[model samples]
Target: MTLGFVMLVHTAFDRAEQVARHWAAAGCPVVIHVDGKVTRKVFRGFRDRFAGDPLIRFSRRVRVEWGTWSLVAATQVATERLLQTFPDVRHVYLASGSCMPLRPIPELCAYLDANPDTDFIESVTTDEATWTIDGLEAERFTLRFPFSWRKRRKLFDRYTEVQRKLGVRRKIPEAVRPHLGSQWWCLTRTTLQAILTAPDRAEIDAYFSKVWIPDESYFQSLVRNHARRIESRSLTLSKFDVQGKPHIFYDDHLQLLERSDCFVARKIWPQANGLYDTFLAADRPSRRVAEPNPGKIDRVFSRANGRRAVGRPGLYNQGRFPRQGFENGITAARYNVFCGFDDLFDGFGAWLARRIGGRVHGRLFHPDGARFAGAERVFNGCLSDNPTLRDYRPEQFLTNLLWSTRSERQTFQYHPGDTPEVVDFIARDPNATICVITGAWAVPLHLSDLSFADMRAEAARLQRADAAMTATLQSAGTAARLHHWTLADFVAQPRDRMRGIMHEITGPGPRRVTDLPPMRDLTGFPAFLEQLRNDGMKPVVMGDFTATPGGRNGR
Candidate 1:
């Protein structure tokens, strides 16, 4: 996912720097479009903050507005310039001064790489534009404005009355109905270019001319109008709290933020120096590099310094399992292990929520049984805004085999429906890994034989389980070497040692799978490693099986 970030900076210099520092660390090409109305002193000060890094782009200052079309104009123009200036860039994201990078840029980029042709512009159902939400609808009047905004100021209220009577419907074409939503997005290079060079540029431009707060709806509406396939959500993951901030990124919101798994978060306060520091501190353990701005497309393992990467690649069978769909083929070049579990433990589901709420090197998934996606469950601790309890289920035997890390960095996907895409993702990428069988169920795989009598039957089962998932990746042009392994064979082996053994059995293939890691290994990770290595049957340990994150979705 060769992504270039564009941040709309207004007055918050410190917040801009804070976000910049965080972004710079992720190794993405960053472009800052400061409000042109600001003084040179302001721009220069921000410039000095990133003096040496060449990847950081600074656009000619342009005045932006809160509810005006200027915001959209500013972002679109900046994005255009970036595309022209950096033709090689693959993805362009429109962000705000308050946004912060949630995942490492490389993982995010690799994800985008798997879905090349798709445009991630803001999109909603066609009727959403004229639809009502939270007791308000944009299309209710010939013109629509956020209800909160109307309530905030008397002047705006009067403006709404006048606008309503005037019926200023901005001459929307017969086919085009604008969806009023967040403008922030991560668009592919082609879409950004097409948007910039839209043939119906005049028509599109005219549509937003009279829309109140066109900035919020302009890009969102235009992209949908031109899109073949659109993701109807902003890439930035935010908490929807009663406080009604445009975004939810308070330091206190960390647990849910990590759980949500959206790559970037926005609208942070500049004065929260301690907050930024705390973020850096909390994320310190996951840091892939020691320096601030590393190179773009950071292959953490491939890096000369051999930095331990943080985010997990969602690859399995050479296919990747993102939130919406499955992608296959050598997803991430780096080594990554994603884990999952069976919902067997008492508090295991809740315990697992923490991991999904945090981060993962790959994906965080759970199983109803043989099915991959089923129900999801979060820890009871998380119910109170912030998750409290940790050491749940207290499986001494399990803990003894693993040392608890700072927090769970995982995501959960319940597989009641068939999604064979998981297998393809794991098989396509040789280095990518996944976990299965949570709680006590995953432990038996280590101790018993997991081979099946009827090979064709097993294949038939998997094929039927997720025909669409299987078809999607296979259609994408990648074949997988599918096989069955007995847990009895893999039991009592170090995970790394297990991989070597698997390599021998599977041969030098682009994609393959061996077995799931025992996440409930409370014994201690070192001990678990030692056990898995003892038999040379050990494969890569994706994660200890237990309740990780969002386990509550099991319903």
Candidate 2:
């Protein structure tokens, strides 16, 4: 499980030397590529610093330029050199001299060994919506810009604008769907080899040489097109501002850098002396190197179910069971039940679980339940002292929930109806049953909607999201039984009536009663209900709860 590194650097900074040392200490072979632009004296000084080290090798210098084909050429040179030198290297990581390891190298290597086939690269489709550069998708490949634009930035910008106005656009080569990504990545040896020795390598390189910022797109496009088991995520953490410049880390960002799941973080300024020591000191010890847990259920469930149950309990008790029911001695159950906020009817799921002899495992998304629970306790304490703070704002609660559960590194983005963790849990748990409770909130809906048209648009968006989620679940290869309980059907007398019913169902008193708004419209509800039915999920009004308690109800 040997790892290799291709460190691309221009200036022979002390930080680069430190980075090389770190990788070498981790038992990785380091291949350093000094930019051809650097002076002979500087290069000699760098080479002299690591004179007798067999693990370290220097690539043939390539004059690297920012946002040009030269950058890719330099990377290619380093990658090829590393492979030629260390043929047995399992994985090769492409990074810059400024990047520092966030986690212990052993842990990263172990994870890589576990996922040998997966390529850790962040890639997006060419038509990615979040492309920061204006006219990037079309202009990057279509515009023929001078390489000298790197030096004459202001003049080139005006020239580019004049060319655009003149309606001169170069057609991207046929059959090449341009994909873009971060320049840094960790790729399996097989994938890197494929990129270097690709059949269309010459043609692709020639085409990309004329493209703006070819370094960002060349490897990503080729690897995404070629790699068999690519995981679209980069292990390197980098922060980009509005202008698209990578943030230079200083002493203040140590806490954030420590919390990142990424193995490495980039653009550590050379001036930040002793920052490296601080990072090294805080690095966590590696976990036991072994194969990942075999069962898909075990992996996803263990991560999603939060840290509870230290040692294995009985097969039935291994799954999460409500504290109340387990304490009350309602233990005997044939099947496990996983319920979420939508499924809980004033804690009716727990009541139903006990009634039907099923163990109730709480929601999957609230993996940080304990954290939130502690925060809630503190909030309650504050309210007890100052009654004025007891505004009981639903929006406030929702904001807190999002903030509390948000991922430390990436933004917690999810489609409205897509709960992958929940879906995956049900798919893995053969004996598990899922109850999806659906209802519209009026207060939150009204607050969110600027007008009735906005409310309609919101309803349409939710409907689409729900449909997508339902499709995903139906496609999942699982025999687990699922039930959809629509609150609208149960209390259809009035719009406000359903809200009141939901309030009653999700209650234990003031604290249990959430400030969630009522449903904005009953229009999209029927479609979702019908889709559930079509997908073989039993759709029923809330009054039919008794008929479907536990695993008794089925399509």
Candidate 3:
């Protein structure tokens, strides 16, 4: 028994010629089908290169387009010519111009000779097919696609929508169970003859001509009836991405392809010199005779598919800026936000950084500028502290900060005086750990050397902002870990709150908390609250301020 090959050539003429010569040298007959899109002069020149070999023949040309009947038509003409010209050939393998033979041709022939009667083609029913894209599975067989999805996409879509609206579905040909699979296959001569001469050949051809991407379905569906024995899997190794596009093998994929142990692999890069040279070497090292197992490299492709679909966490680029609610994650790592602690204590950021063993920044969203750690003008990833840039896209600013320093835990101060819109984003992020000391903003206002009227008005505005943020943090759908306390309540038992905050930040452990940071003096804070109330603005969320020492000793 002899094996024949029908290779569909479109692009990469040089590579195609090299592959054709390789196949001819292996004592196998090759039939080449060059796309009509190539100029006649170029086609003649390519054909003339193989003029010396009698085993190599060129078939009639056809203009092939993606997702159209032309590809299938091209294949049909090539296969018919090969079968008619090669009298002793019993099996025909279909491959593309970009395909490369991975194993020795003798090994492939021996494998085929063992199963001369079985057809190696993927044939899965439409209901069982999960690889179809754009919501067209069974609809592909029923709908008439007269326009090209590649060149005339808008018209094609409009026509499809019109048909859907008008409920116009083409009737499937009788006795034909529509199936889908990869366009590549290896079929026995008997099965090919049977399908070509079937009584309903004209009807099947006409029906499939209007089906979308008919090349993937025409032979696959027809083989179900004519093939005496079907393995239902292609011998060629091919993998597609999440977007339904084939993965091109590059020079880096040399080992990855070898691990598959398949006879052939498709869609190799034209410039991948390493793969072509290594795989096409005449005296290549012999591999063990084992069944083709593409599953060996399936895990690598699966990971690549996931990276293309979901993307890496906290990373955003032009190609994969996912739609809203589709982000893999909002931030790279967990970080802490101290809402009012900076105002109520001296050197709180430094003190907290020491306790939690993490970097801490003061008022990252402050109107003046982002107060990065150590007062640096620029921090990780060259992120500047310019107020305008940070405020332009506060959410991206925070995300970038967290992503750059993801190796260590981060803590930053936040206040009602900062960016108000960022509060909602923080509340929604599961990676945020927010600690709110409510009404502590009043301490800074009271300490400032401003008129009583100015202090009262500023206090009211800040209170409103903080109140809105508090509602967002305490909402039913909040995902961040929130720890809120009234100013008076926190000072009443400062030690316990500090200990609890440390535990939450560092996680549960038996670590002891001995020395606490000193708190700012609140010598006339109660009177200050009374003054604000008397001036027509009530001090709410403060929880009854009183003159008392609640720092370090909690007394």
Candidate 4:
């Protein structure tokens, strides 16, 4: 009724020897399988190191390539050797060189003795298996994977595509309903022997040899036919990341592993001296009563997987530069984009800063330089107001600004006359709050002392820019909160519009805006628009305005 181990050793020979000797000392027989790819000199040295132990034996080497039949071949040879060489072993525990025993050997032996007939292996139907990676679920069983996924990835992908296009699926044997799980398992000798000596073993092996990553499915699938009672879970704890790569446990994961209560854990870092020293110690405590529950530490791995996959929102790094429209968020926090507001109202940035209680910057995309709130050359995160740097990657500059000042609401003026490079980005960003007073750029042109000809040409250019910006804001795909007001429409009820804008920025509050910012004189604003129209440069975004009889548009 004693336990036996079959270790699949490919790397970390020194650590493998240490673990093998430890198991031998605890009276459990072990069969070692060194990968054929290992150099003869290294294999001979590794074999010699374990020669003194009678409980240890080496199986025939197999050249193992990941996601190919070689891995299954290696495991088959090692597992068959273990069953034959150690007849007294009732349950054969399959492990890897990097796997370390988390619990004392006596406790694991006793636990297996309690469930002597129960085979502990994770065998679930493909539909039930959530752990499969790379979009290959049942396809791994049906499709042929001749190319090495690790070495010849392009060939593997192309071959898989060709198979799919040609509808070339391998016929799975009628007895074998494909089941996938962790490659590691612990099975009773009866079940293991039945599988190795099944009447149709040759046919099953031939079919699976062409299956993708057969090591995970071969024993996992056959156990159904031979096993008396299946627990449908592995005693060995192994975790894979979002990319289907094993999570390597380092020294820091010592406590994390202990919490799992699993008998063995694999993919340990060779440099994890703390784990080896503590777990392999002679006096390691035995927890016979506790059930193996890797779920205790699942949250930690789940969070790690999430961070690696989705990453933090609005934070771009070399590893996770998300594709467009796939970013968690385009900007870090909510910010304001005031288009044409500055021209319509005097000292708008300062006024908005008082109303919203946040930093208010003026013309951040201005061609001259960023007109920061205090006219400072340098801002948060040492961001320069230089037009060249800002224009080089305007979206990045805006994102950096929001990321740096995430603690406060950011309000910045953006006119069509300024750089319109970041306009589309802001429109797509859900964090942006855009308040536009369309055609307010005309107010600034009306105040300028430029010649009529100069004014007309500049007006046309600004109008074109404004039209583009408005189209983006009004588009069906825009995510930004838009508050668009025509120049004439806004001037009619400036106070009401300002209050609404302030409320949206600051959310609902008791403190009302007692007074509105003073509006610039529009005495000849209508004449200015009429003059532009007469000169054949239409200012249509301004909305129709009627001249006041008092010689000025009333404040």
Candidate 4 C-alpha error for residue 422, in Å:
1.0
Query: Candidate 3: worst 10 consecutive residues by lDDT?
Result: 546-555
Model 4 worst lDDT window (10 residues): 546-555
The digit string of per-residue lDDT tens for model 3 on 31-84 reads: 999999999999999999998898899999999998999999999999999999
Ranking of all predicted structures according to lDDT, beginning with the best and ending with the worst = 3, 4, 2, 1
Go through the candidates in order and give each one's C-alpha lDDT: 0.49, 0.59, 0.89, 0.87
- Tell me the spans in candidate 3 whose CA falls farther than 4 Å from its real position: 127-133, 161-171, 451-454, 546-555
What would you estimate as the lDDT of candidate 2? Answer: 0.59
Lowest lDDT 10-residue stretch of candidate 2: 406-415
Q: Measure candidate 2: CA RMSD.
A: 19.0
Candidate 1: list runs displaced more than 4 Å.
126-136, 139-141, 144-156, 166-170, 241-244, 271-275, 278-555
For model 1, state the Cα shift of residue 529 in Å. 92
| Model 4 vs truth, CA RMSD | 3.2
Off by over 4 Å in 4: 127-131, 135-175, 251-255, 272-278, 281-284, 303-307, 373-382, 448-457, 530-536, 547-555
Candidate 2 structure quality by residue, lDDT tens digits, 245-323? 6667888767656655567888897777666886565355675443322232234334423334332221123354444
Q: CA shift at 342, candidate 4, in angstroms?
A: 2.3
Model 2, position 443: C-alpha lDDT score: 20
Clashes of each: 96, 13, 0, 0
lDDT tens per residue, model 1, 49-84: 888886687877667656655666788777877786
| Per-prediction TM-score to the true structure, in the order listed | 0.46, 0.51, 0.93, 0.88
The worst-scoring run of ten residues by lDDT in candidate 1 lies at: 393-402
207-254: candidate 4 lDDT, tens digit per residue? 998888888899999999989999989998999898888899999998
